[model samples]
Target: MAWAGGQVNNPTQADAMKSRLQAIEQDLSKNWEKRDELNRTAERASTELKEIQERGIGLARSLYRYSAKADSLQTRLQQMQERERSKSAAMARRQGQLAATLSALQRMARMPAATLVAIPQPPQNTIRSAILLRATVPKLKDEATRLADELRTLKALRANIAGDSKSLAKTMADLEKERLSLSFLTAKKMRLLEKTRSAEHSAATRTARLSARAGNMRELLWALLKQKQSPELRGEDFEPPPAAGKPETATAEPPTPPRQTAALAPFRLPRGPIPALGRIVTAFGAKMPNGTLSKGVYISTRPSAPVVAPTKGRVMFAGVFRGYGNLVILELPNKDHVLISGMAKISAEIGDEVLAGEPLGEMAPSTSSLPKLYFELRRQGRPINPLPPKAARRNKVRG
Candidate 1:
C-alpha cells in the first residue's frame, strides 16, 4: 500500500502566503477607510474654522463700533457735566439776588417797629399794607421752590447720562474679550486641521508602500507559477529555463531600437453625465478569496446605466464567462483587449465597433442589491494596469 502520510501535502508555504496577503489587504482597507474619514473630518474642521473666523471678524467690527459708541457717550456726558457746572454758577447768582431781596423785605418789616421807637415816619399799619406784604412773601417762596425743582431735574439728567456711559463701556469690553477668545479657538482649529492632513499623508505613504510590496509579491508568484508550468519541470519538482540569446559559451550585447512615445493629455468629461454611475465596491487588483488576483476594477451600477468604453475598441466577446457574469470583451486596434463583465443586459453585438466613452448597455441589479461591473485592460492576453500612461518608463542605465 502507498504511504498515506507521504501522500498528504503539507500546505505550510501556501498558508503562510495566504495569511500574508490577507494581512496586507486588511491593512490596505483599513488605511483607505481611515484616509476617507480623516479627509472628511479635516474638511469639517476647516469649514467650522472658517465660519468661526468670519463670525469673529464680524464680532471684532461690532466691538469696534460699540467702543466708538462708548466714546461718543462719554463725550456727551462730559459736555453735560460742563453744562451742569455752568447752570450751577448761574443758579448761585440768582439765589444771591433772591437772598438780598428777602433780606430787604425783612428789614422793611422791622422798619415800622424801628420808626415807632425812634420817632421816625409812622409805620403803614393798615390792613391793605399787611395783605400786600403777605402776598409778596408767598411769591418769593414760590420762586425759590421753582428754582430747587429745576436743579433736581438737571442733576438727575446728568446722573442718568453718566450711568449709561459706564454701562456701554462695560459692554464693549466684554465683546472684546469674546472676540479674543474666538481668535484663539480659530487658530487651534487650523492647527488641528493641519495635523489631520499630515496624518493622512503619512497613512497614504504607508498604503503606497504596501501596495508596491504586494505588486512585487504577486509578480514573483506568477513567475514561479510559470516556472512550475514549464515542460522542463517534473511532476513534483520545478526547474528554470536557460537564459535567452546567450550562447552555450559566449554572450553579446546590441543597441536597442528607438522607443515610441505617447502623451496622455487631460480629457474633458461631459457635465452632468457620468461615464459610469456606480459605487466602486471592490478595489482594483484586490486578492480573491481563493488566493488569486481579482485583476480589475469593480463598479456597482444600476441596470439601466450604460457602461461606456474608456477608450475606442471593438467588441471581442459578449457572452457569459466562468466568473464574469454576462461579460463583454473589447480588443482595440493596438492589440489591447479590455474586459467588462457583470452585466444584466447587452446592447452592442459581438465584433461591433465602439467609440471611446460610448454607452455600452444597460446594467441590472446585482444579487448584493449593488450592481457591479468588473473591468480590465490587457495586452497580449496578460493583464495590464491602465493607469494615466502619460509618461513612458524608459531604461536609463546609460547607452
Candidate 2:
C-alpha cells in the first residue's frame, strides 16, 4: 500500500508541474502579443504625426503667401484711394473754374448792343472789346470740355479704388480662414505629441526641473544631454542599437529602437539652413548696434510668420531662456546643436523629435514693430554659423 501511494503521489506532482509550465507559456505569449500591438500603435501614431506635420507645413506656407498678397493688396488700395482723393479735389477746382467762365460768358451775351456802344467812346476800344469777347468765347468752350474730361477721369479713379478695396477685403478673408485652419492643425499635432510623451512624463518633469535650475543656455543643454544618457531618464522605451556586426539570435527578435534615438545618431555633416522663412536682417558676424559682433543671423519675418526646424533633431530645451524670449534648442546628430529664439510662441516641447521643415513656432502678431527670428548653430558647445556655405557667400557679396 505504501509503494502504491508513493507512485501515485509522484505522478500527481509531475501533472502539477506540467500545468504550471503551461500557464507560464500562456502568459509569455500574451505579453508578446501585447508588446507587438503596442509597437503597431506607436508606428501608426508616428505615421499620423508625420502626415499632420507635413500638412501643417504646407498650410503655413500657404498662409505666408496669402499674407504677402494681402499686404500688397492693402498697399495698392491705399495708393488708389489717395489718387482718387487727389483727382476729386482737382475735379472740384475744374468745376469752379468752369462755373466762373460760364457766368462771364452769360453776362456778355446778355449785354445789349446799344449799351455797349453808349459805354465805349472810342471806336478802336469798342473793336478791341469785341475781339476780346470773341477770344473769351472759344477759351470758355475749351475749358468746359477740359472740365468734362477731368470729371470722367475722377469717376474712373473712384471705380478703381472701389474695386481694389473689394479685392483687399476678399484677400483678408482668405487669410483669416487659412490662419484658423493652421491653428486647428497645430492643436491636433500637439495632442498627438502629448500622447506619445505620456510615458515620458517623469523624464519631462526632470528636464523641467533641470531647466529651472540652469543658469544659462549652455548649462541647460549640458544638463539635458547628461540626463538623456542616464538609463533611468531614458525610460523603458529606450532601445540601444544592437552591437555592430553581431550575429542575430533566432530565439527572439530584438525590439525596434525609438525614433528619437535613431535621430540622435551621429551623421556625416550637420545641415545649416535658416529655420524660418524671412529675410536676413542681421548677418552672421556683422557689427551690431552695441558694437559687438553678432553671433547669429537675425531674420526679419512677417507678422505671425511660421517658423520651422532647420534640420532633423531632438528638442533638448524649449521655453523662455534668459532674454532671448521664447527659445528652442535642438540637439542634432554628430553633437551639433541649433538654437532658435525670438518666437512669440513655442509649439514644440522638450524631447520632441522634429523633422526638417517641421513647424517649430510662429513669430509675433502684427502688433509688434517687427518680428525678428534669431538662428544660432553650435557644435560641442561653441557657436557656429547657421547659414549654408552658398548662402553665406551670397550674403557676403551683398554686404
Clash tally, candidates in order = 2, 0
Q: Each model's C-alpha lDDT?
A: 0.52, 0.71
Can you write out model 1's per-residue Cα lDDT over 1-399, one digit (the tens) per residue?
A: 223555525477557767999999999999999999988987887677556545643443343345345546666878878888888888898899889878867866777744545554345554455567678888889889988997897789778777977786786576556545644644564465466454334432332333233223223223333432452432233223334353221011111111101211111132111224444555445566776665655666533344555556666455555555676666665655667777676554454455554445446734457576776655433554433222112111000
Give the per-residue lDDT digits (tens) of candidate 2, residues 1-399: 124644645767778878999999999999999999989989999999889878876776676567667667777888878887887787788778778877876787798988777874797897787788788888888887887787788778778878878888888788778777877888898988887777566776777677666665656666677787773653223233323353321111113223322433312112235666556788777878977667778887767777777677888878777767788989886567889999988888887888766778888887547788888776555555565445654532111
Candidate 1 deviates by what RMSD? 30.8
TM-score of each: 0.38, 0.71
User: Using TM-score as the measure, which candidate wins?
Assistant: 2
RMSD of each: 30.8, 11.2
